[model samples]
Target chain A: MTEPLFDRVALIGIGLIGSSLALNIRANGLARHIAVTTRRRETLEKAEALGLGDSYHLEATEAVADADFVILCVPVGVCGAITSEIAPHLKKGAIVSDVGSVKGAVIDQMRPHLPEGVDFVPAHPLAGTEQSGPESGFLELFRNRWCILTPPEGTDPAAIEKVEAFWRGCGSNVETMTAEHHDLVLAIVSHVPHLIAYNIVGTAADLETVTQSEVVKFSASGFRDFTRIAASDPTMWRDVFLTNRDAVLEMLARFSEDLASLQRAIRWGDGDTLFDLFTRTRAIRRNVIEAGQDTAKPNFGREPGNGEAAPGESTGS
Target chain B: MTEPLFDRVALIGIGLIGSSLALNIRANGLARHIAVTTRRRETLEKAEALGLGDSYHLEATEAVADADFVILCVPVGVCGAITSEIAPHLKKGAIVSDVGSVKGAVIDQMRPHLPEGVDFVPAHPLAGTEQSGPESGFLELFRNRWCILTPPEGTDPAAIEKVEAFWRGCGSNVETMTAEHHDLVLAIVSHVPHLIAYNIVGTAADLETVTQSEVVKFSASGFRDFTRIAASDPTMWRDVFLTNRDAVLEMLARFSEDLASLQRAIRWGDGDTLFDLFTRTRAIRRNVIEAGQDTAKPNFGREPGNGEAAPGESTGS
Candidate 1:
């Protein structure tokens, strides 16, 4: 059998991404020993109960001591402080990484605190559910998803390749790009879409004309799809908008400007403009499906016997 | 077996909703005979090929003649002209209903041309996918879905109950409201959500810095969900905006206002504001799930073995 990838690997933060990573690392024997740490005793105990790691620590320094690789799986907002605390104890030649959603901000936060001889490779796994916490994770969360790595200039080629292989072992296809490019691409594809979803759900809830019950009861008509992403972890998303502000704002401006034109077309009864834009958008859905980023099944395959209420029984999505 | 609900039913459009209705009607024996009509010969032939109807015709007059029930299952924009063509041939005391999305405009379009003896009831079945045409339908499309019926005040009570029973037989929970209220409610629940989905997809496609391929690659983060509804039928959506202009504009303005505040909070780095909104929206998702409007499964159950590319394989959603 192949040897484990690392002798000792430290996973800081045992939330959804971290817990899922723990499951993958252990299930695939990606690391010889797993050291887990988190801020809360309850979360750490839960991780222990789940057997997510070989050893557990409350302090960042304790977890990082002599670890060959360290991955910060916490929200991006707190990476800098955690980096400072763990910098003194990081093993020489240790490969440091993260599962942050925003790359440029995360790199800027962690790169300054790193001690010499440690290689930092920042990555954003394009995989998640709206669900969070230790219990919400599973073994297959990262399987078949893209894990994008953005390493700083002059970083060791050997380190990047090892990290790439590590993610491959966890069941992800690895890609690399500049942090700037990753932020812009994610701003449109992930961050901006999430912002729109949160904004719209909030809007729907605040409306006095449409009761909250009404919105909830009638949500199968497209609104419920937005709620899936809108329901994501609040702390993680707050940090995302706080750190990736400029790129998100730029993409959001484009979104709002286009929405204005659609609203105008509606007001003026310009059927051609509405029809043209609507037709163009359909092609993008086809591309997303064809590229394997999504499925073609109706309603995302939420149908009868999939736990939905069948006809003459109950109302469901 | 009990007698069928009607001796004959005339359905005047062979699109997604029409074809699905035909399947349900025939499968459940809601009507003894189903007569289908559409403007396109190919669509009529496709419906026939699918065995969706007992008889098919290209002319509205031919389909409606001697029919005990007539349903205009066409787009709202052309409802008036088709209603005019079918009015002169309507059988006395026949119950006429339609499956249009917008109730007020469709009522205004069709009510004036109906002959004296026939009773008119209009309904909007709150169920569909991002697919269209005769073939893109299924028997369970209306199962566990809400179907709203908006009948003109003082219309025969017997007619309203029969249509409700027919939809109930087709596996839907039926509700009644005035035409104006139905338009407003649907504008928030269905029409506005669809517009937002279409607008965001259009905005992403038009970006110069972000390649379309990049958008497709990273779409699993959040944007792919929006693309599902954005791919819905163009002509149908165009008519929705055209006919339900006031309600959609009202909802759009409210949506834009809420988004502006969220954007301002992002620009100013108000983490509390962002966090508060994000937290509040999570509650809405729970309500939707508890109401049976959605499931709590991660990524809507699009996981490994659900046709997704699994770990150590290829990329997938």
Candidate 2:
């Protein structure tokens, strides 16, 4: 067997991403020991029952004891609290990172609590499904996906490299950018999409003219895709919106303005404008397929690492 | 083999829905002969090359000649022209049906041209992928989806039943509703969703702050789903907006009001409002899942459907 990359890997908040990392660590033997911790005892029990780690603890301090690598996998709003709780217990030369969607806020909240001996590296995997919790994760979730790390200035390079290698072991391609850039990128890609989806679904739900049953019945026409994305974990998304308020608001403002223009076009019967915008968006979908982000399948498999392997994978197309 | 339901089946505008119906009719032997016609000669040639019909015609009159069942599958905007052109050629007892998204406009456009002995029925099969064109169709695309029929009052019940049976043969569950209600229902379910998806993708494309490359690179979080729907055929969707103008505008107004409230919530850091909306949307997703509208696999099998037969049959989830 290959030698373990680290003596101990502490995962603070054993949810979807955390448990997936645990599975990846065990599957690839990336760490000699795995420490799983969460704020809730029930979730911790679920993680332990799934045998997702070598050790489990309710307290962040208990979980981080002697850990060489620590990854924060909690909701972004909770990251600051977890960081403060675990800071004093971090081992010397430990590397601390996260899998939050909003890097700027994650860095802002988490960087202050980090001890001198530990490196606070903010990261987002650019991956997820609507499902959450420990049972919803798999080792292959990160395969062929992007993991972006946003380390602060003057952070240790060796620590960054080790974390990079660990993610690569889990089958991710790594990219480094500033936390601000990550927030801006995701605001357009992730946050705005989720917001619009949630907004539209909410709008449909509140419609007096059309019932919810009707929406569900006729959803195959295109509304259902938005519903699936809007169904993502409420707590996680709430935290994402709250923490990344500025970027999301900025993106939302732009989206609202654009939507208003579209509304006017529809009002005045401007089919040409509608067609032009619709045609331009097709190129983006093509680019996504080329990036290996969107598969060329007639129907894309949902849920991370489930059903069938991705097109880029060797098992099958 | 089952007895043919109609002596001749004429399909106008042989694109995705029409082509799929052609395949379904041939595979199931639902009609004794299929006559396919499209406005463009190139599309008619492609249909002929695919052996999609017993006879192919560029003129609507030729396609409808001697046909007992004539199904119009063109964009809603062009319904009137095709109906008026083929009116004199339609058989005395023929049933003229359409697969338009907006029923009231379709009825208004096509009804005046119908002969006394002919029945005009409007129906919408709530199914499709993002891909369009005649080549981007399969026999099973309508399997288990809803096919809504709107027959004007005093129309022959026999004609409606026959059309309903045809959809059932194509593997759809049929629902009957008034043309007015159908327009409103679709405004919320189908039209509004497409409008929002197109608007958001357009917003991202037009952004000065977030580059298109950045949007394409990180679309997986949620934006990509909107792009897939937004990538649907521009002409078809453009017609949907123009023909269903009033209902679409009404729904668009409701959506804007709700979006404004959501915008205010986000700006004010009202987490509870965001959380509640996010939570309510999950139930709609569950309803969609239970209704068998969403494809079962996560990511919609964008992987294996491109090549392999994935484990599950694709039910649009």
Candidate 3:
């Protein structure tokens, strides 16, 4: 077995991503001491019951004491407040990072609160499920998944390597990207798709002609797939849209414009246009299957039997 | 075992649904003689290779000759032509039904061509996968699913009962409804969902800012689900939209209005609205599960490694 990556690692905000990281770190012996913190007392107690960390702390400041690396795993909206609350307690030369979906806002929000001696790295782990909360997490959540780190210019190379090594130890492939680029890429890929799902579900629910009962009854055809995504934790998504407003809105504008064209084609009964677009999308699914990002299992590669993936079989590649 | 439902059952256009019905009929001894017809000679040959029927015919008229029951499984656009060709050859007192998604248009198109002696029962088996073609089907596809038969007014009660009993032997729960009601219900349940999926996928593909590669890379989050539905047979979907235009348009209009409201909420950072909608959608999913319309398995109840349930799993309740 490999040596422990860090002597002590602190996780602030032990939600789905955070608890999963702790579980992975413990399962792999990646850290000697794993300290966890969450804003809610009940969540900390639940994490304690789940044995997600070596030590649990409700206070953000207490969790980071004596930590070699501190990873903030709360929602993006809370990153700044948590950083400010814990900044004074961060150990000298400690590396601070986050498991946020949006990168630019995270840096802007958390960088100022970090002490000069500590290295502040903004990282986004492109891994999650529709299920949220600590109980929904698993040890293999990040395996073969992408963990992107966006470091501001002139950051210490040693600090960057340390953060990269930590994520790698947790079974992730590390990639370095600019904060803006990360946000833009995610806006198109994750953010826009999520927004669209939420909108469609909302649309289906509000229909007077098509009762809610009917949408649920026949959802298996196509709509049910969107429901899993749409049913995601509303708080996390609200923060995502608010923080990543520019990029998300840009993608939405493009999406709306394209949707209008499709509406027009449908109205005009243009089979050729519909056929061309439908044919092109098939390649993307093939690409996802090939990348090992998705399993070939029928019905979106949802693992069978258990609600989650089998033991040691991570959803990500 | 119960007696065979018909002396001879002729299926015109043996695609996924048609082929599946043939296989189920054979497995359950629902018919003594099965006749298959397809526009393409290659499909007929392939159906023969799979032993889908006792007799395979290229001519629609030839296939229906002396048949006690004839089912048109062709696209909605071709229903009228197939009905006209097979009308003269149909045996008197035979029951004729179709597995078309849009019942109203199908009835209108085929009603003129049907002989007075033959009963026309327009049915929509409320089940299917994204896959198409004969090889893509299996015997247990309709098990525990709903087979909705929309018999026109003044139809013989015995004719309806025989059709209902045939579908039941193929592993379906039978329901009788008017052709118009079937069209409206399906417009909300299946047709509108397919259109939205196609439209969204088209939108994603046309984005200049978000390359196709990025969409594929980050698709596991939400977009991949839509791609699967969008990848369904183009001709079948085009025919569905064309035939179910009014109900689809009405449902689409409602969907669009609700989508616009959700967009406004996102723009204005209305977290309450987002949360409320997200929370409410969960109830419908639960209702679907309770109604046995959705499989209890995490991913549509098709578990990996469980070959038994996977092959013949019901697409509907």
When sorted by DockQ, best at the front, the candidate numbers are 1, 2, 3
lDDT of 3 by residue, A203-264 (tens): 77777665787666656545666666676777788788878888887877777676667667
What shift in Å separates residue A183 of candidate 1 from its native position after superposition? Answer: 0.5
TM-score of chain A of each: 0.96, 0.93, 0.94
Candidate 3's DockQ: 0.31
Model 2, range B204-313, lDDT digits (tens) per residue?
88888778887776676677777777777888889988888899889888888887888788889999999999999989888877776665444554441123322111
Candidate 1 clashing pairs, residues 3+ apart or interchain = none
Model 2 TM-score relative to the real fold:
0.94
For each candidate in the order shown, give its overall lDDT on alpha carbons: 0.87, 0.81, 0.76
> Alpha-carbon error at B44 in model 1, in Å?
0.9
Cand. 1 Cα-lDDT: 0.87
- Name the runs in model 2 displaced over 4 angstroms: A301-317, B295-297, B301-317
Could you give the DockQ of candidate 1?
0.56
Model 2 C-alpha lDDT per residue in residues A55-159, reported as the tens digit of each score: 999988988989999999988888888889889999988889989888887888888988887877777887677778999777667776678899889988988
In order, what DockQ does each candidate have?
0.56, 0.45, 0.31
